[model samples]
Target: MSTRTLPPPPPPAEVRCWPDREALLADRAKAMAELHRLSIGVPRLLLLWLLACGLAVGWGLVGAALKTFEESRPDALSALFGVIFACTAAGFLIPTGIVMGLGVRRDKTVRERLTQWSSLDRDPTNDARFRSPGVSLCWFVPSFLLCTLGLWLSFATPATAERGQETYADVTMLMGLGLILWLTGLLGIAKAVSHFRWAVRLVTAVPVSAGDGGHR
Candidate 1:
């Protein structure tokens, strides 16, 4: 992952001063695009995590099938289960691995773009730093409710044979946690996207710099 930070903004007074919108809009658009590029990695990381969970589930199903076969005799159904589990695992793992790997590769490119855009002499928008507290609350509200319901169901439901005698409570707990984490990650990515949109609007609204200007 790229560890570089964006350069700091100019003085407060300069930030208050607006430049020529007509002249700076094009350059601002380019800079906004670059900023947008920097925000994709976190979402890709989240997706990778999701796929890993799927792989784990598939592996568990396969293990159950194997255990069943060893305890008794291999049946057509058992073989089918094993095959299905293998395919499911591969289905989740392969494409996700590829996409996440691509995201890693693109991280450097995004950082480089940010560096190039930083040379412009404009104050940075508070887009990334300026999220409303209510925004986070809104995201967490659904997550909390879902987690609560999931816990109730996990405890209420019985364990299935496919789960190898594991309690529904146990499995549900694991799944619920995974869901929470995934949702949290999605929230992060969404915030990053929102920041980009806010940056675009901020750029449009801010006064254009006469001598030099940069964008968020």
Candidate 2:
């Protein structure tokens, strides 16, 4: 007589399909590509903002230089200045704001989704490096803070005549710095989105014990 032992049965099919890298990658790539494409326009938006700032400064200088023209026909000069300001806002500032807004929204959405997916295997201790904040935040936060301070200074009543002039100059400088910071932030965001596309590719390409659930 002989005794024989049979091997245990394999695990159920459904148990092997929870974390499918290929399928996750395919979905994530589609979402991220759309966002990355939008980010490409961010630098262009920054350039437009800078151009608008330059044009505004030039317009102010022209007005200041033509004091006689401004004093003689104050109403007409005011109207002309208004038109130029309106045109700049409509043609450049508004469009740039819209693009940046959309990019920010899309970036937030895609990053959140990816974070959720990555959490399945992400190590808790790696949060500082791997789960860091977006690059744009580094510049955007400080820029807005400076901008707010500049605006407040512009409105605040000065305690002395000499202080008023200094305050005005300080406000102008702070606003200018804010604009530069904003541009830097926008550029950083564009690069970050581009980098995210590659990260998505790498994550999806990783080898996992669980299959891609029939996704190629």
Q: Candidate 1 — which residues are off by over 4 angstroms?
A: 1-25, 34-73, 123-216
Q: Write the per-residue lDDT of candidate 2 for residues 1-216, one digit (tens) a residue.
A: 011111112223355342454454444344434433333334534643565465345434433334333344558766576556545545544554565565556545554444434433322332233322354354345445544554444344242325435544344434444454445444454545544554554345443323334222
Once model 1 is optimally superposed onto the true structure by TM-score, how far is the C-alpha of residue 198 displaced, in angstroms? 13
Worst 10 residues of 1 by lDDT: 2-11
151 Cα displacement, candidate 2 (Å): 5.2
Runs off by more than 4 Å, candidate 2: 1-78, 124-128, 131-137, 144-148, 154-216
lDDT of 1 by residue, 124-191 (tens): 55333433344444434544554455454444444332566664434544554444344444544454
User: Which of the numbered candidates is closest to the native, going by highest lDDT?
Assistant: 1
Superposed by TM-score, candidate 2 places the C-alpha of residue 47 at a distance from the truth, in angstroms, of: 8.9
RMSD of each: 9.1, 14.6
Candidate 2 TM-score to native: 0.38
Predicted structure with the largest TM-score when compared to the true one:
1
- Native-referenced Cα lDDT, model 2: 0.43
